[model samples]
Target: MASVEKVGNIEPMPKIYPIGGGKGGVGKSFVAASLGALLARHGRTVALIDLDLGASNLHTFLGMPAPKDGLNRFLNKHAQTLDSTAAPTPVTNLFLISSSTCSMEIANLFYAQKIKLINAIKKLPFDYVLIDLGAGTNFNTLDFFLTSNKGVFVCTPEPTSIENTFRFIKAVYLRKIKQLIKRHDFDAQAKAAVLDTASNALTSRDIMDIVATYDPEKERFFKACIGRFQFKLILNQFRKNADAGLGKKIETVCNRHFYSPFEFLGGVAFDERVIDSIYAKKLYVKNYPATASTMELEQIAELLANGQPASSLLQPAL
Candidate 1:
């Protein structure tokens, strides 16, 4: 948890948004960069940390070369603090903590290092901290995403991407349930239910059943802790031919089945020019403001900034 000193009263912690999905090539980095830029444009201090580990490339999206000082320096103890590794981006009010400087073995961070990094991230002084996670549901990725309940999952409209996204969501949800059980010292039955022989075979309902039977108070506490999670989903590379209501439909399904609230923050229209913008080393939202994809991104950025749903703006674009 983030700790704050009191000047007169406790200061509000930065709103951390970990952008991740189960698969790569889903525009996770693009969305993170665009959202960071948009939020900074709104006069909020934003820090974009590339937690992509072995596959870091977020700096390119911001039209800047990789920075020499980044997470690697802090992780290696060369930097005293994680914030010390932060390098300013070309965008005003935006900072970048690239992982490009990390060694090849950096992806497999040790347990101690991971915990230290997580705690340091929480201490970063910024209005908004956006972490661009690498692909997959690895323990590290899932833990990073869970560092804040306000995770933004990005996926495309393709069946495979959507399937991977669902898998990612399940992994994250299960991880949180296990943490709660351990934290509150649930009975052996509850632990067994969660750690069945088969991998990820137990659902939230199954564990909750065991937990409720063991202790109703713990069950309620677990439910409340899970319920407090506010997850947001975004669809990328959306084409007109694809189902426009797909995001909302997924959101509905997740809400009905899971304990946490899931909000679909609309889709970014597919545009080939995004590739062109990338090749030219330019920020798409900055150079192509009038494009369909950019406009959609802007709307998503606004919704994130306001931290509320604008039903009219959230309606699927036809």
Candidate 2:
């Protein structure tokens, strides 16, 4: 667990990545744990926050009993800071702040409480912080996901999961546009791109067209906000020949439909050992080093930790 420290001595803000699924039982937690374990194994200080909130169960992936102290303490005033509640996990250099112990009402966080937690999350001292979010495209989930330096969407190859994940991505994009519009002093053209309800989001003119609609000087300004988002995708439980190629397919769909800077990071293959590791209450990457899943997870973590430029990650000609 990371001990509380004063802000003056801390380094740069750590890379924050929030992982969420369109629905449950798609192995979002499994993929999250594997990434955390891999990052920790590589000697990065990692914090895995189980923001599945009141129903938190990420501790199970780390092979631990339910956390007795965490977000609840900070929220209920038992602790002064959220970072102080990070509980040490079995993995070296990795800590978890599970909130399964929180009361049911904690799931419905007030705006003030959510802001407080978000501010605290940014201040936590670590190389990487991966938030495991609850299922849904609700305000809480999208807010947390957007707070990440890079938003990660995890979904199975199933059509339902893929469609819902698309919905979640679109929801987050709308939220992102709203935030950028509020924060930046956008001119009329830029404002219309975001505020216009009739704009075809997936077809016709996308964000680039909106930026070009502005005056030449203002075009750069609008592009800086509309064209600069980094979101990563992971396809899990991949089982067939087509499944292996779904990464590029998703990238194409995102480009054509949402004008999104979504990068298909990689895919995780279906493996029996994953279930075995889960049943044994251990992270598959840490416990089954020789497995194909572990190898794929290691590669994905490496790519994520390397942190490519948003434009480079996205498909060309977008």
Candidate 3:
């Protein structure tokens, strides 16, 4: 990947993982922070970016009493480059680019600002860059989530969380479709047919059928674009073996319902110490090494570090 200095000038994009769940209190910032600590422990240089906008608190999770500088500096032109805004954390080889200064208005970035931020993030000089996205499927949240080399979705067993998780995935997929077709014209009839949100043209199959009806050749290529959307899922707040199976169930539903690759990378059991660590101002992975959640997160981090495929996530770990 390119150094943060040369991001906009033909530098390679870093391996970025944007973590988000559709709802708040779903453990996205926690997962992002813990994963960043674990990756640093594994000897990889990692950056945890808080893109939660107005509700940003990832710095607190990382034990940052006060992040004096961050993304806002770059956005406001106080910092010339994105790298300069990254603040050091207690963990070695791990840094943080917080959104603590962002307000509700900052969440809605201008198109030019969005492009600049994305370019800088893509070229950060780190082995891994994990973005903690905000709750709900807003355009900013979805756009950041889509910027990842591998998007990571965090959800608990709660029915609402599960449903929203699916909604978030579908939103991202459909957004990609819209992005692809926005630049290239299909047929006027096909455009009007699918773009009509009131209709039942919701599924990938439905859209493909509409496109195929208009032009068979374009349908094949558009289907390929849809097939490229891939992401990893982590089930959090798991309390029992039944809850463990929720990950598998969600994966199955997504595989059957969506066109892209979705994998469940094991679940983090509910551990009281996680909260205790949070209150103690220490990273859970750093303070509670023996906790079940910490161990499971380490396994997930190992798999991610090793470049394990989505198919491999089906197997149990650690």
Q: Which candidate is the best by lDDT?
A: 1
Clashes of 2: 1
**Candidate 3, 1-318: lDDT as tens digits:** 222122233435567899988988989999999999998987999999988888888877887675877898899998998988989999999999988876568877887787789878887889999999999988778778877537999998888998898888878876666665555678888887778878854865567777889867787778776676568899888887545467888898888877778888879898888788788888888888867788788778877888663343345455
Better of 1 and 2 by lDDT: 1
lDDT of candidate 1 over 23-136, digit per residue (tens): 999999999999999889889999999999899999999989989879888988999998889899889999999999899888999878888888778778998999999999
TM-score against truth, every candidate:
0.90, 0.82, 0.88
What's the residue-level lDDT of 247 in candidate 2?
A: 87
Residue pairs whose backbone atoms clash in candidate 3: none
RMSD of each: 3.8, 7.0, 4.5
Deviation of model 1 at 233, angstroms: 0.9
Q: How accurate locally, in lDDT, is each candidate?
A: 0.86, 0.77, 0.81
Candidate 1, residue 85: lDDT: 90
Which segments of model 2 are wrong by more than 4 Å?
1-12, 183-223, 307-318
The CA lDDT at 285 in model 3 is: 85
**lDDT-sorted candidate list, best first:** 1, 3, 2
Candidate 2, position 226, lDDT? 43
